[model samples]
Target chain A: MEFWVNRDCFYKAISDVSRAVSAKTSIPILTGIQIIATEEKLTLVGSNSDIFIESNIPMTINNEKILDIFEPGSVIISAKYLIEIVKKLPNDVHVKMNGRQLVTIKSDDIITTLNGFQADDYPKLPRIDEDASVRLSNTELKELINQTTFAVSKNENKPVLTGVYLSFQEKQLTLAATNSHRLAIRKLFIEAYLDGACIVPGTSLNELSKLMQDESGHIHIYITESYITFKSVNMTLYSRLIEGNYPNVLGLLPKDAKTVITIKTSQLLKGIDRASLFAYEGKNNRINIEIEDGSKMRISSNSSEVGKIEELQNIKEINGQRDLNIAFDGRFLMDALKAIKEEEIQLSFGGSMRPVLIEPIGNPNYLHLISPVRTY
Target chain B: MEFWVNRDCFYKAISDVSRAVSAKTSIPILTGIQIIATEEKLTLVGSNSDIFIESNIPMTINNEKILDIFEPGSVIISAKYLIEIVKKLPNDVHVKMNGRQLVTIKSDDIITTLNGFQADDYPKLPRIDEDASVRLSNTELKELINQTTFAVSKNENKPVLTGVYLSFQEKQLTLAATNSHRLAIRKLFIEAYLDGACIVPGTSLNELSKLMQDESGHIHIYITESYITFKSVNMTLYSRLIEGNYPNVLGLLPKDAKTVITIKTSQLLKGIDRASLFAYEGKNNRINIEIEDGSKMRISSNSSEVGKIEELQNIKEINGQRDLNIAFDGRFLMDALKAIKEEEIQLSFGGSMRPVLIEPIGNPNYLHLISPVRTY
Candidate 1:
């Protein structure tokens, strides 16, 4: 495309889309970013097979001139080279389409010509009806994504398990993810009605979280049978939904347990961290947790090569007299503890070998379950 | 060792010595840190084949009890595990030698017993004649190492090129290193006696620079045929010297040149960096530089796949009217520029195809020479 744009404006736009560019993609054109310069704005698009990111820079932003479109055209350039060139350009750059696929960029003292592919070779973005969409604040969506995405299975053997399941009914939206070893669930209230469940890849949720820099603004999400699009100001991200049915995980959480203890989240996190030194040397990083008189808990781990460590954490509230001692993966417990935002957390144990339930104090909407390891 | 030390004191001492511990050594004892507990002091030693670092934590410092030595004993424990355990310990730790080699460390609520190796298995520290040692300020030594070490050859093909050559005569000390392509020479005045030239590996110099954090006082250095010892307050670092004779590079720098140019170091560095982006696509990151009218300079680079970049820099002075253009590796130039602490630098060019001389504006004690590359 023929256009003259400020160095920083073009740089920002190119970087936002470059996140989706993968050099190892099977499709050659997918590695290139598409640039379409109209009389009013310039749109940059980059896509891999699973996710696509597009950003637009208008000719006028806040009544300030950002670009001058000499001619309306489109071209596709290597995302890697485009970013490096734009960042290293001395001043404002003038970009022009040379031959059929050659793009020339000229700055104050530097002139560079890069090979470009035909814009038509790039894949088309998914289209969905804008009217059938749900709205949620960036803060709420980012929080929900962070709380559950880490627990998603990284293996692609079971496609649905690699994605986070989202279900919305009335004003409540629930997100859950599990990798069989651990499960995380979170719920929040929204203003729109979303009744259907969709499986979104954990990677896409991570990218969306990074793009949501502002917390207060609302993000519009349009969902189709196969794809979902999240649109914000000047940017749109499209992600393909995994095709399959998600497993039911509600039965994994405990409804009643023999012992329940509430302890300060930070205090218990530090204790587990100390014990992890010895646990990390063990076969499975297994650490034992013992609750005594319901109000006292001791964490211990040991290895033959390294030494042993036992830390006693104080519990403020206890429900039953039954004592329970169980061993679980220290990493999973650390992750769950970090996700808890409240001052105190309640841990419910069904048995020595059963899945343990961890949740923020007085909050049942967010629950974390970890399967204990057989240490014996 | 049997001792009771404050958590912070023990942690700091162990961390310093662990830097010298080698996990890939053929000798298994080299992976462990030797701890010798005396009635007055506790010493920690860690070593690889090339370097050894020892730090002492005394029982009393400034009339304050930092370490309490219950008995006199010695043992060697895995450096990796010991560091991790001491770092995570809650408060004061009580360390005791159980049998001959087994050790137990007890903190407030944690008790750990680790298997240890016999202290006799560890190699003894090298002995040097301290009477013939020379003293230099830590700041001066650190500066000299930084100014010349980066130019040392990283390839082990020629072992001597990997070390920095140090020569002392009367009170002047000259340090030089070259990788055949570029050379860095630095000279300083030290109050020392006659000492033959010594070759110290660049890797050892780099590590020594980091270990010499105390810049207030002088450090005593004892150099031998096989090893060099650097002694500070309660720390001693011993490094094996590389065995070989360094090449003579005193005549590589041009004493007289047809053209001389003075430019701001920062501006030239930035120009070269920008031009290198395109040049990097070529076989060797080669960038061209042209000086015009003794006051202006231009830098440019281009690749067929990527574009081209040209930057113009203003110079303060030029001694000759002859215009000279040359091409060189951008990475080498960047490294030399970063080593130069002066604001302005003087460059002397002998011809279009010869090495260029770069030195600080008024300082003749330090010089850097870079060979030019043929662009055609």
Candidate 2:
């Protein structure tokens, strides 16, 4: 294989695909990225056992000759060293491998040669069924992952909880994640529909969210029985589906809230943050929210060792019945608040005994529920 | 004590004083900051046995009322908790501490009460002698610390080597540091002078450099028998002097050169950085520089396990009459280059076995010496 590619373009492709490459893998070759050079494009693939990412660089982009392919071939090179080398190269990189285990990379006067593995040793990519492909704008895809991924269980005792549950029916897709303590659910209307539900690892969704931030194109998702693939113009991500039945969480949603409090999101977030500091130093990181006559709100936390903090803010709007007091894990509350990108939010409390339903003032598609802590 | 201070000013003083405060201390009170409120100013002091930092918030600055003293008193508050509270407070912070050991900090509608300790338990400040004082601009002080500190020996086997040797003689203050492998020396002319030399801890100098970056006033350095104090208008830092006789490093300076090469500092730094990648993977992180025919230079590193990299750049200018090949630690070379902050640098070589002298082309106040690695 012999090819000369633009330094920056090659670096981006390598880095994008390397998001899936982990140095600590059971299989040695899994730590390397496979590089395939063809007459039309160069392909870079990286994978651990759970995630696979591929990025492609064409020979010409926007009428600019970005790649010169003297020969077409393939090699698997160590991702760690190759990335470091390519990131620091000052000019276009020239790569050559002629039926040998050594791949030579030359840029300007700097030449680096790394030991490569045979491409035949790489694992085969999973076959993605093309029959039921769903297309969503990058923004919608990002929102689906960000709003729900944070609520996924960090504990692996129940593997299904460690992944985000995706359900599609009736031209709408719903994403939910819960760690038994709190839950986040978001729904968006889609042009097409899928038949069933699947669970994708929260970590993969996290990586996808960050990568998609810079992606402007729409994403096409295709799923097989065991693997799910998200494809864009130049990038592809495939994640192994968690093999388990997700717990039925729709029943856990509150039917309605008795007391609803609407307040500025920033003000509430800052108040909770200060209160949580003291709560964290003391007992179970619990902050209590008190609503009085559905007119005013107070957020307070008491810590015997450190200090105690109490913040009172005037409510923008209030509705429903008598007073209600509820306590929640401070960190969980902060997570839900940060995930929200709105100015004002509504908190619907269920008499301080049931979970609090949180939603943006205007957007009804996103909802976060936090179970109140029992202080008894 | 009862006082109302500007929230931003209070936070700044708390953070600056908290730099010397470490939670992991044998004496628990040492982990807290002593807050002394008087009609004149509010003083915050933190100590960790080795370093002490004091910052003051005056009653008014530039006709603006920044502090209002209600009752004059003092208390010791935990630095960890106080910093967090002050950082998140919304408006002017009003601090009130009566005869009780509880300190109440109120801002906006948020009230926080933290447990405090008696101010008597806080350590006393070091008394700096008033005999000979040296004053340096913040920029000069920063340069003095930045240029030589990196070469200080991290190994404590030679305790004196862990500090920078400061010698004041002939209206000049010379600083020197060496790890036995490399040495960095810098000299600057001062208006005043001291008779003797002392050793200051490298870590202390590092912290002081970072803190002084934002300080606009001149720094007056006062030295006692066992302490060195750096005092500005609003901030004062006192560090315990390392008690020992510094080794003689002047003899390590290269007397002359047989081959000299002038190159762009950034270009040379990048070449060495790329070469170091392979060198770090090999033995001893050794990089070789070859000056062939005094017209071109080659920087290269070879690792049998990983690969090898060679970068050749044209030398802008060359001096001396002989060809030379020398090897040095790539990290040491990079450190010297990074510290120079110069466009072009001159490297003077003494054959292939002796130390190389590196200095910025236009500046002579700084000099770096690196011992050649024996590649046999």
Candidate 3:
């Protein structure tokens, strides 16, 4: 393979794909990035068992030539060394490969020769059908991922709960995740009516979110037999689908509400944060909270080894007449509070032992449920 | 005991002193920060076995009031908890200590009661004589620390090698550190005529450098029998002196050079950095450099497992007729290159097997000596 490409574009493509590469993979070849140079473009791919990311550099960008291909071929070089070398090289970069799979990377002043594997030895990406795909905005998809993934179970015992459940019907797409102790659900409307459901690892969604953080425009989501791909203009991300049934998260909600309190999101978030600092050091990061109808709320956590903290903040509004007191994992409450994008949120309680529902005061599209810690 | 202080000033003081506190200390009380409120100022102190830092917040700054002390007393609270609480508190903070050592930390909205120990239980900082102290600019003192400390040996086999040696005579205060393979020496003039020498741990110098990163003005260096103190306005750092005879490093250098090369500091630094990236993965991070009279320099490193790198750059000037080829640790070269203040540097080699001297051209204040690796 012999090719020359703009250093900045190549650097960006390599860095973006490098996120999918893991240095500790069991498969040795998987730790390297595959570089393919065709007559029209250069494709850079990095992958592990869980994820594969590909970024393409077109031959020319806006009339300026970014790539000049002398020979159309491919090679796989160690991602760790390739990235470090490419980061330091200056100006336009030229690459050439020898018969022994020794690739020499050169810039204006530095020449780095790296040992690479033959392209034929690399693992090929599975075929994905573009017809069975739904297009959605990057912003809306990012919201869905962020709102629910934190509730995904970290315990490996239940593999399905470690992934986010996506349910699409008609024009509404719903995403839900639960860890038995807490559940988060978000619903959004999309123009694409392709109805489908799949469970994707929460880790994949997080990586996808980061990929789209600087990206705008639309992203096409394609679900195949065993994999799902999020493709954009010049970048594509493929993640393995968890082959198990997701829990019925909607059925886990409490039926009714005994009392509801409305408070500013910042106040509650800050209060819970301070309380959890001391609470998290204890057994379960537990905090006791009490609220009455149209009155100030009290949040407190005590640790025998550490000290105790009591924070008081006024309530914006409250419903129901009965005063209520409950104990919960403050960390769970804080996570839900942070996920909320609104300035104010409402807290709805079923009972001392039942799950509490937290929702933004005006937005009906998102909600979180937390099971109260049972205290004797 | 009770006091009210401005949150920003108090926070800065605590943050500065907290650098000396270690959470993993053997003595439990050492993990806490001692706060002593006097009629005129509030003193915060944190210490580990190696270092102690104290910062004092006066009652007033310029013309504005920063502190109001209702009573004079002292308490020691967990640095971890105290820092977190103080970071989140808003506006001014009010601190009150009860007879039971249960301190109430309060702001307008948040209240935290932390368990504390008697201030007398906290380890006391060793006193250094102020009369036998040298005054130096923060910038110069910081430069001396940065230039010489990197050569200190990380291995604790010889405890003295882990510390930087200081020699004071006449108006010049010389700092030297060597790890057998490499040595860095820096000398500068100070106003105070305190003729004494002491060895301070490289770790302590690094911490001291960070403390002065944003600070300006002069700092006082006090040398007593057992301790060395670097004190500026409102802040004081105390470090235990290492007691041992340093190796005679001057006797290790050769009298004359067989060949010499002059090159841009940045160019040589960058070349070594790129070579070291591939070299570091191998056994000794070894790189071979060759130079003759008025010829371009070539820097190369090869690894059988990885590949090889050859970087060539034009030479500005050269002296001596004989050609020289030498191998040295690239990391050591990079560290000395980074410490150099001049754009042009002179590299003088005595022979292929002798120590190489690197010094900034036209500057007699600092120089680095690196022993060449003898490869068969």
| Whole-model lDDT per candidate | 0.86, 0.90, 0.89
lDDT of 3 by residue, A1-376 (tens): 8999999999999998999999888888998999999988999999996799999999889999999999989999999999998888868999999999999999886788999988898878867897878888899889889989999999999999999998888888899999989999999887876888999999999999998888889999999878999999999999999998887888887777988888899888988888887888877789888873448888888888778888788998878755888899998998899999999998889878888999898999999999999765
Please identify which of the two predictions, 1 or 3, would achieve the higher DockQ against the true structure: 3
Interface RMSD of each: 2.5, 1.0, 1.1
Give candidate 2's total backbone clashes: 0
Candidate 3 CAPRI assessment class = medium
Give candidate 3 misplaced runs (Cα > 4 Å).
A292-294, B292-294
Over B1-376, each residue of candidate 3 has an lDDT whose tens digit, in order, gives 8999999998998888889998897899989999999888999999996799999999889989999999999999999988998998867999999998999999987788999998888777888786788888899899999999999999999999999999888988999999999999998877767677889999999999999999999999888878899999989999998998999886875678878888999999989988887788876789889863448888988888879888888899888855878899989999999999899999899888888999899899999999987654
Cα lDDT for residue A226, candidate 3: 85
Cα deviation at A376, candidate 2, in Å, is 2.9
Better of 1 and 3 by lDDT: 3
Which candidate number would show the highest lDDT if scored against the true structure?
Answer: 2
Listed per model, the TM-scores of chain A against the true chain A are 0.96, 0.97, 0.97
RMSD of 1: 2.2
Q: Which segments of model 1 are wrong by more than 4 Å?
A: A60-63, A213-216, A292-295, B60-64, B213-216, B292-295
Which residue pairs does candidate 3 place in steric collision? none
Please give, for residues A1-376, the per-residue lDDT of candidate 1 as tens digits.
5899989989988988998889898787888999999877899999996899999999888898989998999999989889987887779989999767888888886677777898887888899778778888788788899999999998988889899998878888889999899999998887887678899999999988887765368888898989989988788999999988888887666778887888899888888887888798777789999876556788989886556778677789888655788998999999999988998998888888788899898787899999999979
DockQ of every model listed?
0.58, 0.83, 0.79
Lowest-sum lDDT 10-residue window in model 3 chain A: A287-296
Ranked by lDDT, the better of candidates 2 and 3 is 2
